[model samples]
Target chain A: MTVAADQPTALIRLGRFLRDNPVIPLILLLFVLIGVLEYMRPGIVNERWIGNTIKFAIPLAMLAACQTITMLTGGIDLSVGVVATVSAFVVSSLTPLLGAPSAVTISLAAAVLVGLVNGFGVGICRVHPLIMTLGTGLIATGCLQVYQRFVIATGSEIPSFLEWLGTGRTFSLPNALFLFLPFAALILWGLARTGFGRLLYAIGANENAAKLSGVRSWQVFLALYTLSALIAGITGLLYVGMIRAPSLSLANPLLLPSVAAAVIGGTSIFGGRGGYSGTIVGALILTVLGTLLTLLQMPEGARRLLFGLIILAVTALYVRFTDQS
Target chain B: MTGFLKKHGWTLGLLAILLTLLIAIRVVQPNFGASGLESLARAALPFAFATAAMAVVVIAGGIDLSVASMMAVTGVTAAVLMDNATEGQAVFAVIAVLLVGIAMGAINGALIVLTKVPDIVVTLAMLFVWEGVALLILSTPGGGAADWLRSIIAGPVSLPFLPEAWTFWLPNAFIFMAVAIAVIWLPLRRSKLGLSIYAIGSDDTAAFRSGIAIGRTRVAAYAVAGLFCALGGLSLTMGTGIGEPVPGPYLMASVAAVVLGGVVLGGGRGGLLGPIIAVFILRAIRLLLTLMAVDPNVTTIVEGTIMVVVVMLGAILMMRERRS
Candidate 1:
């Protein structure tokens, strides 16, 4: 009888723990998926696979960071992909004309300009974030197309530093970790410990309340979008280094995946309840899933279909388990 | 006159903008004639349908990013099924495609309702799914519709015993759009479901408190939007005489049109007429730009700028009203 009573208590405690910490299950799910992959192909979970997954996943997670941060404020940065593309394309196109450093600076500045436009639209004009970002993204793409004509004669080149940082490996780990570790740590720390971070959560939870409390919400929005764009720009530079080519639509494919990563990581689209730690894991899961899909040898169409279906299934299951409402 | 102006102020403003655009196009290209107008109608039909579909979903407090993909899927499916088929078979294929579109949309609605996931997330996933399906149906855009179907959709209006010039002013595509609007939108707007859609969009809790079935109405809105998307697909296939599995450009254009037409993003306050007019205005602007020999890339820039300016103007007006 004592044993039976103890068993119920233990089960209840486990249940309570899960209810409190939702990311725990997501981590477990990631592991289960990995285990399944390993089961399907023995010895495929080696150091090289790990390095490659991280190499690709780092850029995606970086892009998703923009979504995570913006989503916290009940908005999204649809311009992130375009911003990344512009930064990548500009840097590549300008490197041959100017030095790498100036090219990088100018590319990032361009991203900042786009972000400011987004901020102005969202914060001051009160345009919906989706529409504002979408419009700005279109304008940026058009400008990039125009800019391409001027730089077409110059050709493109990736900076050596970015190439080293993107594709290099050290002791079975991706060199990207050198950049990503500090970046992730800062985001995690900032989101938790900083007043600005708290402001994001507050605004997302209740914008009117945040405004009533003297938050200067528009200023927050301006700063927030600029920071998001800056991150996307950085991700673009790193991504171009990894891919070793920058084109007009270089980062477009990553847009939906980044959004998916944020959503799957439990970053609520409605806003105010998520973190970067989960998004990092979400990116890893996607990379692994992509690997598995490749191994399955399915056609592109089937792979995409399964990819979408799996994302939907995982998100649905996750919400069902974690959501009290 | 005052009451009329008060009621249709936004529509009148949109019409004025459209008129200015047309005049600019005419001035830029002196030979802009009946054939040009017919081609413009032909080119704008698919997008008009897409904008209408997007407008409905946005007005219902949910957005279907998959509408463009849905159009692609339905278009390709119809094309593949109708290829070299008998007239009856082609008609049957069209019906089948419509049903498939409805089923796809209803599935979208059911998933959102069942999973309680946000509409954007679910629809985003569905966008990929539908695109994949389109790719599956037509791997590389090599499918054709029935000949008669294409003629009916893409051909000029030619009434028996009427002069060619007189009848050429009205393209069959425009008639299709009109018939669609009359047969679908007008009646639906007067129905109870339409009221519930607007009700839920404005305030779901209040709507629910008043005993409106929010879930069902939202689902209906999606279903109706899906039908419009299917119509869009049919128009595309018929106009082009083939299916193209690309939906990205169309998606952007449709969304821009919806916003340009004065539809509020959050929902509950918009109509089809404004978006239809916006479509023509957009087409006219592009035509004007082309006639002026501006770089094609500049058109994208101008479109984006116009969208931003229009929304900013609307927001400012709303602010003034609220202040007063």
Candidate 2:
């Protein structure tokens, strides 16, 4: 009788825990999806598969970091994809001539320059983030094309360190975790604990109010975009290492998916809410879904159609559930 | 004069820029003639229509990233239906294609309303969905258009009773553009739905409090945008005489045109006329770049730079005006 009475309290406690942490449901959903994938193809969810999934998902999650941080300020960085491509292309082409370290440094610097321009446009000039980033992205693409002409004669080389981090495995676990874990922990900690991070939320929630409270919103924007672009540059390096190829459009395909991941992870596009923890789960979910689609052997068109449908469905359901309790 | 300038300064500024570009083209290519203008008009039809579509939705405080995909889908649908068809059948095919576009747009509107998803996310999803559908319709970039339909859209106007000088420089596409403006834009501008769109975009809560049907008006705005996209697709079909599954450079170009045209991105402050003119300006810039024999890669840089400069100028102007 005492055990039966305690069971009701435990059930209530679990329910309260889930309600307090919405990310729990998403986590549960991720596991459910993995189970479905395993059931579909018996023994497919092995250590190797897990490593590959994490390997591919890292670049995407890193790119999504740009979106999540920007979206927190009620803005977006549409140029992140191009930034990644530029970084990857530049680093690869320069590695042959400048050595890997300096090439990586210069490529990251280029990304910072682009980010500075974006920040100036959005923060100082008061241009909308979408237009500012789009214009900057276009300019970057154009610059890349011109740069390509000069670099066409030179061969590209992926940096050895990046390659190891991107593709190497340690005890059946991805080596990328060495990089990602620290990066994610820093972001999570920074966002939750730092005054600068709180400023982002304040500015996103209401710029005027934040300004009234002496937030210096423009400075925040400047730093935020610069940091976001730097992250994108890092993602590019890792992506090139993983794919072992660099092209003008290397990271373009991940652009929309990154945004979707952030949105699915419960970051409000309008801003003022959400955390990096949810976005990490979101990235994992998309990677698993991609694997499932590939295993289904569907045509490209059907694959895209289903991908869109599932994102829509998942976002809708996620929103519905979260909104209620 | 100051009052007049204050009222129409933006339009006048745009016109001056356009004239400068045209003059520059004339100076660069001494042989630039009526035929060159005609060809430019023909080339610009698709962009103008597409920009108009973007502008309308943007004015309603939403962005549809799928406009280019919608154009591709509708264009391919038209191509498949009108291939080898007679004149009457081609007309039917045209109407059906437009309906298809409107239907697709309505679905977008309904989904956004029902799901409470942000406009950008829903449209972003639809961008892939529609592109996928386009691929399914034409696995490759190959589909035919009716001969008469092509001639009507892209052919030169040749009125037998008119003077050769008057008729030779006119493109049939220009007439279609004028008809579309007359039939769609002007009426929509003066309609209640149009006012509601502006109202909602400017302030949805206030609009809701004022008893405006936000959902229906938003749907109508999207549907109108879809119709314009259909027109753009039809222009593409006529210009190319075939269906192309890929959207090409039109998507970014359309958005750039909208922003450059002085329409505020958050909506409710711009007009279609500005964007239409902006399209010609963009085309003229391209033509000038080509005439100057600049590297094609550099042309994109120039275009993007010009976009940034123009918007920056607009921002500065607004700031000054506000201060004064």
Candidate 3:
């Protein structure tokens, strides 16, 4: 349908404005925040710092896209961090078996299976999203640990392909960015262009109404959860390729970066509203903010407190200004 | 029997477990003896503080996953304050830590109440914030506590009367819990604010219509939870003899204990007594694994597995009741 034809009446005109205008303000906000930081310190936009910001943004970029996909259907996969962990371990284990190609396939397959199970458990069983995913995420990590300890062994793994994944780049861009091309294009097309994309927004907007209006409820649930898992799995596997192990293989605590990344990206926690496009922006903002703070040698724990405070503040503002309910 | 089972259910099951494990220990090491009763006091102490803290939030139908980080933050801050402060200043640091808990928690409550944001999300954000702070401050996994404080907390306290042999095996944390239970729990239970905490959790709109201040109650509930978390954090500070950034397991472990104590996650139900027992039972599992000399990795696996089973069991029980 034509853009004008698809536009809603006066009631929804404001929504369309929001959906369209959200990104510009966000990008501007980033610039403004950066400008202030730079003014205070001067030269944050220097070439080297810019380069570092891109590098910093890569991992979170992978995470945001993954998180955004699931969030589109109104769910958050707490397992993304663990998925990063499992992928790393699998890569380390598989490198010597049939080489990286086979290992990559195994990792992807595992992610698909996990995604399916997560989808089915959440969508069909109708378990609370947080608990279902948390339970499964725990089990996945435990099994990985079991495999790491007894089955495979856990230690330093600098698998050859992993180095390529983590460090490889073309000209100036990360090779990981290349991996996201298919995901970004597919997601943009699926969510914004295709019938299924419309279905997802519809489902997210109101699951009951969507179902009553002929949406295949369970199928939609299955699709969103699975898609969310697949994206996370890809990010995880790619991360392993980069780091040569799971993110958790290094054991940075599972606080709420991925979750916050999604939220800060402007994805609604209540569901039925969000875009991966904004998630990318949010992740970038976070990386820059983090790096800048790190430069001053601020205590790491202090940053977490700040991160939490910001989320609370942003959420409060969004609710007051936007929700008013 | 069922009535008794329902009332004393979580408590009975947990005590049975504690007895069986202690008996098992008696058989295994025989002289793994009464002197070791200190282990129970220390083991249960941190969770006792956390679970009580969590009870308030849960009473308002919210959860504070950040308690561990708060625990770590408090632990780290307490350690830092110990070195610089005069005795008087050290006392202020302790109070300061509790205030931080209350403040951190109040933020969660207010955010959830005002934005109608989910408790899970707000707490999740707080979780990150707290842990990140812990990471920067501690830097390393941990550092040692003040000598005087550790000695008093870890050392035995003698009572006056019959003999030194008749003394209770009370750790400082256990004593703290006793004082907190009296100061925090007793009046809280009988307060109008306390009853309203349950009311809001059970049904916010209904509570509001009945003239309860839903928003304020929720905020107060989470704030109060913060206070308990600070105490729990203090216990962690005491038990570990210092601050360590690795409070993740303790946090989740307390959650499992809270769940076991028959305090359902959805709130407006369950009691502090339930979580206390669950925490003790969970600690016994770790203790059992220690006695078995099972790998720490294996212990982690068991902890996660047990958590899933218990949660699933609770869900199943709920569904069964709903179906019937």
TM-score of 3: 0.84
lDDT of 2 by residue, A1-325 (tens): 3463568666556555644675887898889989999999999989899888888888889999999999999998999999999999999999999999899999999999999998988888888888888899989999999999999999989889988987889998888889899999989999999998899899989999999988888799899999999999998888888888899999988999999889888888888888888899899999998888888988777777788888888777766555643
TM-score, every prediction: 0.96, 0.95, 0.84
Per-prediction DockQ comes to: 0.75, 0.65, 0.40
Model 1 pairs whose backbones collide: none
Any residue pairs clashing in model 2, and if so which? none
Error of 1 at B18 (Å): 1.1
Candidate 2 per-residue C-alpha lDDT over B229-269 given as tens digits, one digit per residue, 9 for 90 to 100: 88888889988888987776777899999988888888888
User: Which residue runs of candidate 3 sit more than 4 Å off their true CA positions?
Assistant: A1-16, A34-52, A72-74, A112-127, A150-165, A192-226, A244-248, A251-255, A296-302, B7-11, B14-30, B84-93, B111-118, B128-175, B243-248
Could you give the TM-score of chain B for each candidate, in order? 0.96, 0.95, 0.88
Tens-digit lDDT string for candidate 3 (A20-135): 55666568767876886787787667766665566557667766766676666676677666766676667667667657787777877776776776677667666556655666
Clash totals, every prediction: 0, 0, 15
In model 1, the runs with Cα more than 4 Å from the true position are A1-16, B160-165
Model 2 docking category: medium
lDDT of 3 by residue, B15-130 (tens): 88778977886676667654566676677887778878776777678788888877777777677666545666667777887888788778778877766767777887778777
